[model samples]
Target chain A: MTETSGFLTSNGMAIDLTDLTIDKAHKHLKSRDFSAMELADAYLEVIEKKNPEINAYLEIYDDVKKQAQQAQEIFESKEENIVTGIPLAIKDNILIKGKQASAASKILEGYTATYTATAAHKLIEKGAVFLGRANMDEFAMGSSTETSAFGVTKNPRDLSRVPGGSSGGSAAAVAMGGALAALGSDTGGSIRQPASFCGCIGLKPTYGTVSRYGLMAMGSSLDVIGPITKTVADAEIIFKAICGKDKYDSTSISGSINAVSPKKEYIIGIPREILEIEGIDKDVKENFEASIKKFESLGFKTKEISLSNIAYALASYYILMPAEVSSNLARFDGVKYGLHKKGANLLEDYLNTRGEGFGVEARRRILLGTYVLSAGYYDAYYNKANDVRRLIADDFENVFKNVDIIITPTTPTPAFKIGEKVNDPLSMYLADIFTVTANIVGIPALSIPSGAVIREEKELPLGLQLMAPHRGEHSLFMVGSQFLGE
Target chain B: MITRTDIEKLASLARIRLSEKEKSLFPEEINSVLGYVEQIKNADASNAKALQKETVYNVMREDINPDESGVHTKDIVDEFPKKEGNYLKVKNIL
Candidate 1:
């Protein structure tokens, strides 16, 4: 036994899982430095200590030991995968059979998943240990997890601020070292934004790259499942494991991560007009600019580009996403599954169940969706938004012809105080201003932690977002790994 | 400006019951969001083809008799608020 005595611990346990990455964890398990049970215990100890204050995990899976035992068996049998014995946090939206998968909505309260998500199934197949279901924005509707019906997840770096959402809890779990990595579903910046706020690496693979068979439907076309990890290489490992076509998810494609013609002298495009928009914090902008300078120093060239229709991305995303939301969420009517409320009639039952089941933001979006897709307004709002979406995609296609990737700040600011923008729905919607474009265009994007800036005496980290063309996750990994010095 | 009547009409359309307070507050909130999204009307998409509907084709699989297979029937039936055998018991519509 190698002893595995190289971690900082407060309780004086022989092992500390906080600082161990997947590679190190797997190495230790293989070398018998520490048993997988010891690693799970270390994480459990920390989770027991810190989870209450942070509200990161909705449920710490009871099967942690069972899963670790299986992984330990795999390791002992010399059949270990990269993720074997590594604990991972799963976002609440992804279904894990026999476990409560609430999507942070009361409608799904006490609801157990019938079958496992393909992405999660793949990870479990590779011998990964699932820690628990992490909290999220209720139905992934909000940019901050304050909207979660389960309760807001406090940022680990600063208790007052949010960890970003709707994957806030997943990011927080990884950031606080409660889990080595996490699976986060991104629909308009949920993964990347939270990762940026929590000082971790988050990737949103191309729309069809990761199967969405069991992820709760947010915006069907735009939603994607990705990883949140401490390092880009770790993110890459999880992404490769989870991404590919699944028989259950028709939208899923057999993605090829290795197929990329890497640019000799990579050109990073900056839509200066979009960057010049107001509301971006000075410190955030300075940090972003510093990242750009660093990239330049590393021999990558920057070019000014114009995505003319990009200014309208946020507006377009809101319209289209809500439209999809209203349609996809129509499945949650009282009769079939989830919360059911009795009423005078079937219609009354639906109304009461939905109204009572859905939170404020969810109800608001459903109504907005109905209004936009309504008869008189369909051509004006819904159709126009779809066209503008195409125009946005066209802008990306036009730009990527010259540049290898597009770079922007993940969000306008770092972590903001919880309840800061809750009342102002428009302002809250703007939290994803920089991120919705990638989802709109169906391209892969990565948020790499650039550095931190002091906000209210707390060091809040900022991220630099790099967007690449469809099936261009390898390029993203290349640039991300280079930026992270992995 | 969206009136309270419009908000009520939208609630009815969406099949979501709303409180009297929500009926009053939602108009202002929904209008504000709609007002922000009204910018899409300015985009020149007259010639742009609607790819969101057309380009994305639904994937089809070889026919599998789900009813006979009883694959997810139990899981689906278990969620019904009122159930009898395999049927989801609902209020009499007829």
Candidate 2:
């Protein structure tokens, strides 16, 4: 089972653990083809070789062997669950009790979580072994992992280009076979955009379908945790495991997920108005059109519709997200639990602790948020943004009445070179133009690696994004699986 | 464009000290981003129905007496950065 490519190439062992998907891995483990310990070791071997170049994992759990030992015991006792012995990577922002979850920022350096995030807790209870915490944008603020306080995570496909952001490390880990699957939160395209850039499947579940409890708050209204996996079925499996209500988060809903079996009928709507955006790469647009044609060949209907208000989605999100960020991030003062720097007095302490703790992008957003929420400007900026947000949601509601799912290019371009737009924050934010509307409307969306385009003799992946009506994840998986021919 | 004086006010309100360089740099960045978000002003809200949040509601939990609910008061208090036995320590404002 040794191979020149695709997982465990460096190991050159007879037992190839890299190519095993979730289903195959479960079958092999159940049949005792190899022990769970063996599987964990094989992944650890790959991480050792690849992580230095990729920088995907921030911290590999020291207790991996101990966790795998417990998982092996569970498997031997005939208590196997959906994710038994499955080693998954977690985003740094998600909390696991007694673990250093820093969200890749200096503000919470050396901070340990006192309790586990409800999502991670659910997986742990099912005998899933967390391999490590993945690196991400500091405070989940940027579109590229370059903003991370730790280091920039390079794209596994091309070392020079970024692996997209916020969830860049999670997507890269899964793409490089370092982890079978990983969890990432989407606030303004953090998950899907990276999932696309790194060539993986990333889902952003309908807001409130998955509990946000214990995930370090970014944009509170825009964040939803979902899975980044190698396959759509794996995404479905992880989604079901983590999607449920918890009393800890009042926003979570109980069993509100759409249970309708994916209908065989396929009617995909394309927002012609939004698709005709400026600055879309030639290859990306051509590939996007080619993906649409592939859907047509598979007996799916394609309709060109107008979602005119979608043009303003990015604008609305920028305003609303910062406004919420300014408020949510106010808690990290020099008090209680994180980094505390003493100064002359109370005011100086607050200023010094925050000024030194927060990164440039974070401080910029906070100031922008403050300005928008200031007394005289509140109605002009924040309120107007909310009204436009309502309009964008209404546009989706109207378009969805005639279409099962809306399709778009996940990003305007493939992974860009690191430092290409780092200095220009607005240009950096434009990378999320196509992916942010779903967050704005509180709907389920996914980014599936559509195809690849070669640049500098390297194949960088491009993703096709699909947006479904509220709780319409079933439709996304249905169409997504069909498109991927899984 | 927002002036440096306005940004100074924002920094004071946000309680974050900005250096001389940041004071100049942040205003330019903030103003550019504001320019981008200014497009929202075109959407009229005068007659539109108030925006409704799909998932926000007042949650009520049963009042469990401390005896019935197993509360770890010590563990909760231990999370504070500076604690004096069972109480939290903070700088005096008076």
Candidate 3:
């Protein structure tokens, strides 16, 4: 894929991965053309300069210099890894060994993971430097990261609006030059939504694709940890390193993923229904339709497809997510660990700790999860919701037979003002309408930064989400590369 | 038909306290939110179940090998409101 002509092709210190793909970056580093420290220093300098404007990171690791020093040693040692010395941000929910894994909640504030997550550990082995932890929605809830306990993560494109939730900080961190790439957990659109809102590339892998061993669970059935970066190629690089079987996470497919994306690819699927959403922004629609024409011009075939069961995705997602949350969150009972409060009795202490520790949106979700998963309502709601979950999965099973890849608008509208839909749960659910269907049906989806929407003379990047069936992520990369040209 | 009563009970179950205004607001908020769940109250999913875990009943491998991973009890408990000796001291249970 070649560079888009209209894009700002400035060669600067904040050069995105797409400018010089990870392969070029590594090839230069390996051949002693540019020292690893120079690349690390270039990214660190930008983050130091611009992070104050975006607030994408809660904290930047001070040990980055020491890690960079180690990367030089590995280069001198001539160790083999695809991304030796490249910097990446670990979304706070995914543990980075000793780093504070806050999940943007007060409860785990300052708490450190004794052991590293499987994915983080893998990257460390591959010689990737830990830039820092990115912020997210408290326990991966809400759409806009305004729900973060520490503070809201703003859209890099527009300061007034929000970066999308659960992985907003990760998306914005990369968008504003805080890090080269990041890892974010996507359960019910957490990764892809924020990527769209903040104008970065975020991949939500198929359900069993990535390990969830270290992530603070928001919804177990739906959660799959994945990459958020400045381009589709970078996403594929990170995904390759962290994916495959893990004994620690039973849900993670304990198998192998492609060592590299195959060159040959097939036609892309453009679901017609997604473009017809009532509130789909005109710019998003125009850009997506134009992108389709661009794909056609680039020798790719397009088809009108429908998976009507996607309509019920919100219902299935809310039900299954909460049910999983109800079970996963049971561990934080103020006894074994997490935040505790002063009280005269055990029960009161539990109440106060949860009250003070959890943010508003977390409380709302816990209550919602409890309401649906409660014993009396289980059969009437949760049980039936599971039944629909099956239908949603089948819908995908049927669709993959006809298309090689799926395409849709990553978000219905561009990033909204911080408080626009905070109070309205229905609108918030609708925010993930296009993204969540992939999670419900367990398919790999990527939200690629198409181009910015310059509204009122200000620019906000809109995303186009591409999905491939389970383990078919390569198809998206091959097709996406045609548009996100170098 | 969620009510203030329902919100209060739900809050109690969740072990949190809502203000009078919040308590009053939640029932309507929750009811309307739950109204969306009605979309999947019933649907055909004959195919999805085919992919579920093969074994149905408690697939628990007998924890004969009690998880050897040493979780520092004090490491977790020390992060509490108050501690007495070794354990986290808390309010009454009932």
Candidate number achieving the greatest lDDT relative to the actual structure: 1
> Taking chain A by itself, what TM-score does each prediction score?
0.96, 0.97, 0.93
lDDT of 3 at A134: 86
Best by DockQ: 1
- The segments of candidate 2 whose C-alpha lies over 4 angstroms from its true place after superposition are A1-13, B50-56, B63-79
What is candidate 1's lDDT per residue for A422-447, written digit by digit as tens? 99899999999999999999999999
Better of 1 and 3 by lDDT: 1
Per residue, candidate 3 scores C-alpha lDDT tens digits across A1-486 of: 112112221232333333555677788678766667776776677677667777788888988988878887898988858778887888888887667888888988777676689888899987898888888888898888878888888787788898998899888887776677888999888899988877778888877778888888887778899998776788889998888887777777755465324655476777788666667788888988888988888877888888877778887787788778766766776664567676777777777878788877677777878788787888878877777777777777778788788788888888888888988877887888888888877788888878778766767778888888788777777777777873
Q: How high is the lDDT of residue A376 in model 1?
A: 92
Model-by-model DockQ, in order: 0.69, 0.64, 0.49
Residue A401 lDDT (model 3): 85
In CAPRI terms, model 3 is classed as medium
Displacement of the residue A212 alpha carbon in candidate 3, Å: 0.7
Which scores better on lDDT, 1 or 2?
Answer: 1
**Candidate 1 structure lDDT:** 0.89
Candidate 2 residue-wise lDDT, A184-279, digit = tens: 999999999999999899999999889999999999889999999988989988999999988888888776566545676969998766657888
Where is model 1 more than 4 Å wrong at Cα?
A1-13, A16-18, B50-54, B66-68
